[model samples]
Target: MAATACGTGSGPGGRADGRTERVTSLTALDYYTDTTEHAHWGELLTGCGEKAGVAVEHRSVPAPSLVPTALRQASAGTLPDLLMLDNPDLQQFARSGVLAPLRAYGVRTDGFGAGILSAGTYRGEVYGLAPTVNTLALFYDKRALAEAGVPVPRTWDELRKAARATTRPGRYGLAVDADASFEATFQFLPFLWSNGGDERRLDDPRAVEALGLWTGLVRDGSVSRSVLTWNQADVHEQFLGGRAAMMVNGPWRIPALDAAEDLDWGVVPLPVPRAGDALVTPLGGEVWTVPRNDSEARRRKAAEVLACLNGPASMLALADWHHTVPSRPDVAGRY
Candidate 1:
């Protein structure tokens, strides 16, 4: 996506005397609460803000608190000038009239995957864009799998057998986020989708089969009951601590996995129900948006910063740093 000033209208930095005015500062928010992740994003935002001729005030909240905080800010008429939302949550806020369409600020929306573009679009308008995106995959410990004499699984049957073979006293064969949160739903989607289960028809036999797979794993002692309370982060920690031989997680966990000196891990696309079945994973990432606010100038500046953040250089840098795929295909190709 490419964004540039759209018109000569007297907007931010525009003057009545046909001169230019500059917005000096802006506020931005997101859910990057980890110390390293937060600092990385802050640096990117600050750089983008400088390019937009503004200083940015960056803030972060815990993942679960981000939406509620944004809601409170929206209700109080104090939404941050630039807001970052998980793609799944974009529609709710867009429908609530809290986001401005990227088109209104001249953001070129071509060259993106249909799924991600749809994720950022609401009512046929683009409200946000992500620099990079991610999806779930099966991560396994090489040593554990080798010890169990099982190759990486490619289908449900193989996965089940491998899980059973790897099982022992203190370790689980697999781990997944199954808490009563979006993370659980996110983790389950690949199974549901790959099995031909539709969200609209949860009672379908295929959906039932998908759910059965999860329950069967728990009942057979391949997966732990503690999965009921685990989030993705917790699941990753379980894998890192050697309590889990395999995990269903996204690439965001790569940094931590690579940092563990004794760990030798490998990843594969999520297994499918059958050998030829397509594995469908949910799209995962955060989108940057210019929120509706009091000052058009501020909104414009925010848009500028948003544009900078989504530019090719920034996209590649973010993907390299975070182990995510660049959202734009051209950039991803280069990456």
Candidate 2:
């Protein structure tokens, strides 16, 4: 956890007798509100806290409320000693000057993938780190594909044909989170990036081509217009109910899909624009940070716990439990 070198010394108070007092407890907050998920995280934090010689008080809030709650706490000068933020929101909080730089606390910042490291960095300083991360993939119903005589797709042309072939009276060939929210953008990036479309230049021909593929599918009845209102969970529900033969989703859905005894499913990396083009998927995960607080001792203790959470053993355990990829390349290779 990197704390072995830092050493746990005096916490908040010093005695005239010269005996160092250790911090015995710390507070942590995150958005793992689902019962089982929350419990798993609670166990991990407790274990890490034990290694750091402290007890951790772990709490969770709804995902959408996390940022707002954190901001309010920061304003009140009461942010949790250890905090978790969605990767995309880390920059905003770091820029707000409420997160302490991880390096400053002696937390190891190397050995992570470049994209994930960038996600945690603000103004050239790394402020957060995630044990595991995830990205999108194409999940298809094996029975449906077999019935349609379509093989798993590897290119845009194959995907379009497969989708069209799999469409039936009660089921759309493909489903995706296409609601007017960031979920839609998250699902759309692979197509846009793989097609050589730049978000900075939506007017590019490649961007138009990417949009046309999605629109074309809906027009051809291979994708439902209702996708305009569906979020990721809704798309997963549609797939589970057999109303969609294939869906664009992430590995986090694997547990639910595995629980459907009658369903036979397969997943593959998202199809690219061409056979040789690289598929570019958006990175997704939550990062843990030590929020700036009044007590240096408390912050240091929190950093020790943070380091423990990001340690190799913890990363592998998290990746296995959550069906995610480890953030460190070496850990990911082993995973």
- Runs of candidate 1 with Cα error greater than 4 angstroms are 1-22
Q: Which ten residues in a row have the lowest lDDT in candidate 1?
A: 1-10
Per-candidate TM equals: 0.92, 0.88
Question: Model 2: per-residue lDDT, tens digit, 20-66?
Answer: 54577788889887666787788888788877877788889876688
Clashes of 1: 1
Top model by TM-score, which number?
Answer: 1
Q: What ranges in model 2 sit over 4 Å off? A: 1-22
Candidate 1 local lDDT, residue 10 = 28
**Candidate 1 CA-lDDT value:** 0.88
- Tens digits of per-residue lDDT for model 1 on 296-329? 7777878888998999989988888889998889
